[model samples]
Target: MDSKTQQTKWSQFLSLIVVFFFWGFVAASNDILIPVFKKWFVLSQVQSQLVAWAFYVAYFVGSVIFFIISLKSDILQKFGYKKTLAVGLVLSALGAFLFVPAASAASFWFFLAALFIVGLGFSVQQIVANPLAIKMGSPQTGAHRLTLAGGINSLGTTIGPILLGIVLFGMGNKEDSAPKDVNLTKIEIVQKEYQTHKDELAKNVLELRQDNQDDPAKVNEVIAIVEKNIADLDTQISSINQNPGANENQVEAYTTALGEIKQRSTNISYPIGFVKDHLKEVKMPFIVLGIAFILVAIFMLFSKIEDPAKEEEAEIEEGSAKFSIFKYPQLYLGMLAIFIYVGVEVSIISNLPALLHTKEFGGVLEHNIAPFVSLYWGSLMIGRWNGSINVFNMSKTTNMLMKFIVPFVAFAIIIFANELSGKDVSSFYIYAFWILAFIIMSFIGGKAAGKTLMIFGLAGVVMMILGLVYPDKEIAKYFFISGGLFCSIMWPSIFDLAIAGLGKNTGKASSFLVMMILGGGIIPLIQGWICDFDKTSPEGVMGITWTHFSYVIPIVCFVYLAFYGFVTPRILKKQGITMGETTAGGH
Candidate 1:
């Protein structure tokens, strides 16, 4: 077939990445939501993870719906990419609107349902966007092009948490402006929060003592925090019991701890700032996002974004592919790689709060740890920007120079976004070293997706291991945070390798790959359960070893990714696919 696809379609590619931005905005915002949801709902660690579970699982469900449609006729081919993306945006807008009611009711399930719908719409955008990213540029540079798109997506992840925090913590119902009434629900939210801190502190003190019985200074460090937090919890419980509307069980909760109070725990409305109750502020951001989504959809309707095969399809018989989609090992194995990649990516962020709250780590609350989470996602941007540099035609020296320059620019963007939102940027500057390390690694991976995946995957494994066993707690947390760096380019690597030989079936294969995003939901649940699954602690209590050591889960995930990286090239080579060569743009 005679070819018409350009070496690069910068205009169309630019339009496409706006959708990528929305995906990142919502996805990274979920990390912020998990802890907030837990705090609002009085949910245990495991239960709170349902926020991520419900959201990511929808990708699988949405993919299934579209995949079934493809069995009859191709949706992407029939509807075209712009129409499909517009439809996806409209669906996402509807989900975003649901949050208003979700907030009004303060129902956790309602919030989960809203997130699920948003992810449903994202599933469609992802199906269209990824392949389009590849097709918009030289096939040889497809993986790097996708990495460039992901860097744009990472920009969303970088700012999403900050803007979301502004909405969640700094918005409606100003703390000093409101008067206190007596609603037990507010009291319960406060009580659970204090209790959670107390429980985590207690477990940390225990772990510290066990780790070194001789280190009384270390034990005392945690002992003071544990005692203070428990005192706060006890005082909160007394206040709960003082309410006449409290249930029998609610009163007994305190009675078993200290003694009894005169009243039941009920009828206690709180001031806006009381225990940081910002539930009313949650919907404002989503409402804004919903409006934005509708506008984007309208733009898409008028937009000129074209399909991948649109220009080339005229030269070939439309339905004349001779191979089955299943016969490709790249597709099947790539499906598993996508699952593992999405799983590890999501699981790391979702469980990170638990790690931070560990007394050894700092006992920081979720809102306070936004800088860490922001930097983690920002690490992806730093790496992707370095990888994305490949999309341009440049000399090897120029490419090397861009790799050195671009990652820091992306880092500066993260710094500016977070600092502008009032987060301190002083500590975030040290993260530059990690970015430097990734830059060194990107040079090693070159432009080949398989080689890049293999190297980066092993790097992820090493980072996770350091997070697990590294002696310096401060540096160790950074090690764990570096998971985002290694992960930044894996999606393009796997996607590029998987669809190598499947010309027309790329969309179908992509649907299956997108469906495996179910990992993002399920893997987090597994890790979250592990966070709560302490045999040493009784039921309903937070665990000790699992918080820091739970990093082992990602270690396993990265090991498989590394394995896939090693074996995939062999498989692709057997099929006469050489993915490791320096791609079209000189590297």
Candidate 2:
């Protein structure tokens, strides 16, 4: 390439990286939002997860629309990359500002509306960015460029969670004031009655002992008399015996007392009900976030993109036969791979914090320790950094090998480190595993083939299953976190491979690809539903645990990605393009 062309390509590359960073920060921030919304709204595990669902579902819906448009004529040919991206940015900013009202209203649906808008903005950004990046470089180095972009994106993701955590969850406020209509009066009345009864029982026991101290038989007689009197009083109090023609206040008091007794009895009958009820309140934020994500889809109609190449192609096609890009088998497979890969990624990050805190699996670290958990995200950033640094100098086979070996070794070390530390693994070891996995995946990913890198996703699934099967051990718990290292490169790598060729059709293809992100939204909701189901079921029956449900997500992700690894690149090749060569705007 000439110096001017090289510079143009370089400029585009930098711009796409900026785009990735923005979306990465936004996407990963959802992790922090999940727990925060859960707390703020008092939602259940299932409901709180809609934050992911709302955001990702827009990708699916938006991309499908873009894909359809591409079938008519490339949308970029009509609009252009710059205009399209600007619209996306404006929509994103609008979505961010929407949070102001959502937070104030504390209405769950409002928050979801904001999140849906944000997701719509992301659909545009993603659809434009991936193919554009591929266009800027050679096919072989496409993965490397995307990897670099992924690293920057990871950095944004790392910072997003930390920043949002501080803003939302770290405010040192624990008292969640109840809404106006929830009627806490009943609870307060019950509490007061229980306290009064407790005090009376103590006083009666002390008096009975004192009254019969001189003779053992007298002591027994006094005790029996006091117990009978207390029992009679308790029966009257529980029954709330109201005389005929009582005043309104007295009637209310009597009914309140009876209701309290019934509630107490129910609590005794079902111990987990209270916890489940509270969990339901925790999911309100996620619902709001989901709605917000979908609302932004409307912005796409007004958005436009700039592409000089697309304009040139349009002129040539003025009298030619209309071509449909959707007929390409390679593109279909690529879209599926992206959908599955992102789904796995979202599920893993969403669940990692909870998994690390489980006492049954030796997650002794408290939620207060954000630094330890940060390592999981930090590793992805580090791996991306290494990929960027060496993108130009590495061979394909070498890159593939490095990617595979790093994650494998990282998981192995995590297992060994946990076992060696015994019951009390220092928090430092937890941090070390994070650092080690990042280094390994980064180095290996910098040299491995895109296909080989995708295979590591399977390793993550296997580790999650191990964690579920042996929930009694700390090592099993560590495996789930370790899966992060293996998962680190899968998204960028698979993405670069999928849109390998489509030339001017790259923009539409990118949109189609971004739509696959709906996997992230849907899969987690499924997992959350499963978790709620398990929590509600009988202990020893068909009930599945949260950890077990987590295993299913990655297993499905890897199984699909592995198929893509072997077949997707070839399909793209058959379509007359290599796995990393297609360019629309930048990817």
Candidate 3:
């Protein structure tokens, strides 16, 4: 556990983060997939979120399987970390390959199954990699190593959207491409405005329908107003449809709107689920990513990475700890923390494009918003890269300079990636200040995981509140997106603190922590449900109307995290394990 021993495994440690990178790439890419799936499949907001639910819920299910297997025998102990990781990669490859058939069949269930398999694979990978990252170095610097690996993971997140967008939308060379008849510009504006007002319009119609016992005169007046609004919307649709320039796609879009308007009337009902359409355009990307997963699996199979816990193997064999990790209250709290951490992180990014497409919020299209999505994930990269400077054996002056320099360097990479994908990123220069704030925050914590967790968690709460407070302001969108920066170090911080002195119970405890990823599945669905039109009032049986207000879910999540951060150190102190106090060569 000393610096000298930790320094010896540097090469194998370097290769270990490759799995981390893939996990980030695919996870962030799901945000891109969400809107695309929602549009093509005609899914409701809550229904579209099944994409996240299917993907993340697998972590819980897979961890439970692993936990059950461990109850019978130590899976990781028997198979070893390297083999477990390789097996996970192979399983993920199988999952990625499923996307090909899923797309070909145009089956939403197939897509969910593919994602579930991928998450199942990730379950094993996470259990192995998180503990492996910790075990590779001194216990004191375990979190730092995990933070450094998270920086690599965030790099995948930084570019995942642009790359996936190029593959999904095929818009990387838009300047040289001929225009389609879709009338995207008009559709973009109208869809944003119409979606913004549609909920209120529907609420009014429902209220009017509920007034059967009211005065006939008043009922007639409300019905007349609703009819007039429908007529106006129909007139606009007719104009768009009759335009000389209108193409098949535009006409189809208008026809869909007319259908929706009709469905909103008293005699008709709106369809409330995903519609299956034969979509062959998005097949190749899945096939390609699946093949890549196999290649990575092969690389891992032959790689030089060692069994990470060989030193502790004998002790583990002789140990007699119970299967339950609940004995440690910190572990249970950390499980909750992981649940919400992944929940808040996933939900924020996943729903962002939904928020951006609204006229009242960002008013950006799916194609145009990839860069912003890139920035949200890149914000994490910026913070982690800065926090990771200590992993290198450098001089204090060098470390300090690199801490300041690394974040902007990461930011430049994000900009360059966006530009390559035909996006104009010059508008993002303002985020440099937020990047600086993250750097300042990193230095304030000074390599302490608990301290950093508290600072960053509190920052997440403040930023989310700013988003809710100023939902109509441009700063609100960016503030909510900036939650990624504050969330950058939370996993490492909370993971290290949770498993700190568990020793023999660490593996089972790790499984328990991974199980909490169920939060990612549950929280986003809750947010999506809250954003439903039925939930128009926060105090009602439903929730609020504004899309931005759904952010309260993550705000609540971060509050618990800040509490965990503030109290975890005290918990560790009770066990006489004080972290971040020993001065090392790196920090």
Which 10 successive residues of model 2 have the least lDDT summed? 172-181
Tens digits of per-residue lDDT, candidate 1, 430-519, equal: 778888888888888877788888998999999998777777565678888999988887876887788787777665566677788898
RMSD of each: 11.7, 15.0, 9.8
Question: TM-score for model 1?
Answer: 0.78
**lDDT of candidate 3 at residue 13, scale 0 to 100:** 78
Better of 2 and 3 by lDDT: 3
lDDT of each: 0.73, 0.55, 0.73
Identify the runs in model 2 with alpha carbons over 4 angstroms from their true place: 1-5, 8-16, 65-79, 131-145, 171-307, 310-329, 353-373, 394-454, 471-473, 496-508, 538-544, 547-549, 569-587
lDDT of 1: 0.73
lDDT of 2 by residue, 73-148 (tens): 7766567766666667667666766776666556667778888887887787777666566556465555556666
Candidate ordering by TM-score (highest first):
3, 1, 2
Which of the two, 2 or 3, has more TM-score?
Answer: 3
Runs in model 1 deviating more than 4 A are 1-12, 133-145, 171-277, 306-326, 534-544, 580-587
Report the error of model 1 at residue 144, Å. Answer: 5.8
lDDT of 1 at 471: 73
In model 3, the runs with Cα more than 4 Å from the true position are: 1-11, 133-145, 172-278, 308-311, 317-326, 395-397, 534-544, 581-587
lDDT of 2: 0.55
Question: Against the true structure, what is each candidate's TM-score?
Answer: 0.78, 0.64, 0.79
